[model samples]
Target: MSKSTLKKGILQLLIANVLNMIFSIGTNFLLPKYLSVESYSQIKTYQLYITYVAVLHFGYNDGMYLKFGGRSINEVYNEEIQKNISTLKLFQFIMTICSVCVAFGLHDTALLMAAIAILPQNMIAYFKNFYQAIGEFKKYSRIMNMTTGLTFAINLFLIAVIRTDRYQVYLVGYIILSVILWFVLEYSLQRIKEFKPFAFDFSLRELYENVASGILLLLGNFSSQLLTGMNRWFVKGLMDTLAFAQYSFAVSMENFLNVAVTPISVTMYNYFCNHDENKDIIRIRELVIAFATVIVATAFPVKFILEIFLQKYLDSVTVIFLLFAAQIFYIIIKSIYVNLYKARKMQKKYFTKLCIIVIVGFAFNVICYAIYHVKESFALGSLLSAIVWFFLCLIDFKELRYSPRHYVYIFIETIVFLACGILLESIMGGILYITITIILSMLLLPDAMKKIWNTGKVMIIRMRKSKSR
Candidate 1:
């Protein structure tokens, strides 16, 4: 795709995700407000398992991502695509059955329901990743918008119209939606005229090759995700359902902020994979960080709102504050560094970095819980892990020739945000943060800020010209 087309695609995704984020914020706030804490916790649990469903593919999708990135879907043979999907379907079928049996053995209805949802959800993920890999971001964004929109609609109907308090009802709605969404994706794929029905004439050799090629990436991605979610796992396992509910609620809040950043991370992967000359790499990185810093300012207001609406889970208040600030660090690693690593085919380094942080995150949680035994420890651990990963990424990012002063600025800015959130009241902290951040950014990183300002103006002009045309 041309640069112009790519920018338009990215812009489309940004707009879609902004809508998704608004709907998601509604769903997030409404669910907790309407449901009992225990019920909300169960919903979060199901969502947690949904994230792990990617592992069920065992790198099949990741391999496709690595292999087909920067290429069009039509470039691959029809038979090859069909065979890959068929093999994946068969493999996932067996895995689902085995998992269902275990769930039955455990006699957990929620586990059983989650196990059943895995197959359809994983299938949907494959198609989603297919579009992402092929740079068909419009298609990808459509899927995202549909999924989020449907989710919000479902949640609204259940909570507002039906007035249902049963988590099972919600779970059933979600599972049915997953199946429907999977079929929708399949239908869209067929309509593309390049895709055909899978024959199920599978190839063990192809499966093995894909798994081999992508296992490191899969491992790295999974580990990175695990590191990100490790604290939740720790809390869910060790604490009461009420505690898990509170912590996961904070995570849900964090997801609201995170959705806005999704467009850049998604678009950057495609861009970096296709383009080698990254002369503006540092500028892009700085711009992303600046965006993230501004994004962090939203946390204070969210926390303030949550204080009024979700009074029962006031335990999550501080956790929300910390996670939101931590996300600045997380965004830097995710949007800039991780994409850079993947685009450069630095799987080994990527895997190593993830492993290191996972270990540190695990230790941080263990030691903190051992010492303080508070839920906030988990959030602190996540922040600590993110900080560690941020620095580690900088260490390896030698090609950018990024100045040490910039590194210090990032460090200081993050600390200032956290300290503001922790030290002052919500409104006061927010005002102070915005003022300090604006001043520091203007004073210390004037050049980068000016570049970002000019780039934004150009992007706006180009978008307006295209629209007029």
Candidate 2:
């Protein structure tokens, strides 16, 4: 795809994510008001399981992503593309079977909803990743935006029309919405030239081969999730439901902010898959600047918005700020090294780095919790983990032409900047920290600022066009 097309796709996806967050904010506010703390905790916990299960399945989608996205294609008509789709269908069947077992065996309505939701969720991810693999991002963006819009509409109906606060009801609604979304994805795939109906032929050999190939990437993905979700699991295990309710609420708010990062990271992966040094430098610069600028720009607003809507959980705002500080490193890692590792098929390196991050994160978490004994420990542990991973991934910097001087600058900048916001621990403090970050970043990295300005300008134009439509 042309760079222009890539930028457009990223903008569209970013808009979709923002809209999804809007709907989520609705649920975030309404749910806490109506559902008891225990109920909210249960909802968050079960949904967390759904996320974990989806990652655990080790589906062939990641394998397909590598094969199609990383490999140079003479044309999209390669026979292996068909095989990849067939294997994915078989993988979906297995996930479906797991869902059936969970629904029947658990006898818990919330868990059943989460269990069944996995199939459609996987299907949605598979479809999106397929579009991503082919760099047909415009179509991908449209499909995802439709899915999110539809889900949002459903959520509004459930909240305003049905007026139900029951967790089971929401889960069932999610299941139905997920199924409908799968159909939408299927229809969109059918329009693509490379698309084919899944053959009734199920290959045990291919399924094993594809899944086995993706095992490390899957582990890396799972470990990444574990590092983020580890704190929640700890909170759940160590504290009561009410305590977890507070902690999970902050996590959810941080996740809401994370919507801003997804499209950029996905686009970065697609861009990195191109084996061109010039393009790689351009892509990396763009990715880094965009994330650094946007993260700082959104920091204070995130806290303000959450406090206005989720007053009951206002105490979690400080936790959100620390998590946002952690997000700076997290975004940098994913946008650069993680995508680099995947495009290069460096899954071993990727998995190793992830394991180290999680292990160190756990150690930090233990010490922080034992010493401080507060909700902030979880965010602190996560921050410490990302810091270590950033340094560990430095070995690969030679490939990117990054020097020791660059490393030192980034290290000191991050520490000082995050320390300012995290230590100040207020909305004004967050705003001031962001201001300092922006000024220092521009002075230290003028080229990166230029990249950010270029990206920001394009986003402004496209955003206007979107509204005009």
Candidate 3:
């Protein structure tokens, strides 16, 4: 991708996510506060289960993503691609049927709903992966905006108009919306002028090839998801719905922080697909880390918001801070190490690293929870595992190397940040944390910080000029 195209794509995604964040403030925050703890817990349970629904595709979409990355969507829409999609659809349908049956047999509503959602969600995943792979981020942004807008509207109506406290309503609405979104995405793809039309040309050979090529990537991606959500899963299984709700609330807050970071990740993957310069990648990594550092300052205001708006979930505040601090490391692991591995086609190593992290993470959670028998330990364990994951990622950068200074910088940043958030426990502490972080950032990441300052100044000038015109 050209530099202009890259900037445009990133800008488009950022604008869309800004809208998403605005809408999500209601759906993610207000809705939970309005609903009863038990009701919200059920909704969170469904959300957790549904996230794993992507695995049903068995990597067909991932294979297409890997094969088509750095290319245009129009360039890759051939009979072979059609055959692969057809075969994958058929496979997904079979899996969905079997999974739904199992869920019904077990008499679990959440599992059944998640199983029913698999087909539509995986189908949408195919389109999303297509857009990301081909650098068609405008379409991706539209889909994101549409999903969040519809969701926020529906949630607001429920909270204000219906005043419904039943989790069933929210759960059913979510599945129905998924189906509708899938149809909309399909219609949009068909209207693309560059494409002829999709056709069902199922081929066993094509199915095998796509699955074989993408399965490792799919596993790696799934494992990464598992690593992130493992704590929530453990809480759900080990505790009551109320506890699960509180923990999920914390997780949700941490997820909202990703609104800004996700666009950078998506755009970076596209950039990496086209560029292999080590210096550029490292510089991007540092800037991204610096941005993550600065963003943590929002946690102070977030704490106050939760305290005033969702007072019932006040117990989750510390967990929220810990997760927020841990997120700094996770962002680097995700936007840097994982993207480079995929772009470089180091699928085997990527899969292996993720699997190791997942296993070690699981073991840590088990040990920590066993000893402390509290939710905080699980959150702490997640932080520790994330630190290990970050360290592991540094060992093999292929062409890039990090000095001892890099390690010390990240280590000190994480420890001091976490300490400030956890130990101080006041808004004033947050100010102190930000002050300390700024000093550390200037000392440790001066180059990245300088670039960010320059970029901010340029943006301000552009904004002023546009307004004057």
**Which candidate's lDDT is highest?**
1
Candidate 3 residues lying further than 4 Å off, grouped into runs, are 78-81, 193-199
lDDT of 1 by residue, 261-353 (tens): 877888788888877665756767777878888888888888678657678877687888778878989888899998888889998999998
- TM-score for all models, in order of appearance: 0.94, 0.87, 0.95
Listing every candidate in turn, what is its Cα RMSD in Å to the true structure after a full C-alpha superposition?
2.1, 3.6, 1.8
Highest-scoring model, TM-score: 3
lDDT of each: 0.84, 0.71, 0.83
Ranking by lDDT: 1, 3, 2
**lDDT-best of 2 and 3:** 3
**In terms of lDDT, which candidate is stronger, 1 or 2?**
1
**Candidate 2 lDDT tens digits, 33-121:** 66789777878877787777657358466776776784334455635655656666666667777776867886766666677677778
Residue 179 miss distance in model 3 (angstroms)? 0.8
Per-residue lDDT, model 3, residue 324, is 85
TM-score of model 3 vs. true structure: 0.95
Ranking of candidates on TM-score, top first: 3, 1, 2
- The window of 10 residues in a row where model 3 has the poorest summed lDDT is 192-201
Summed over model 3, clashes come to 0
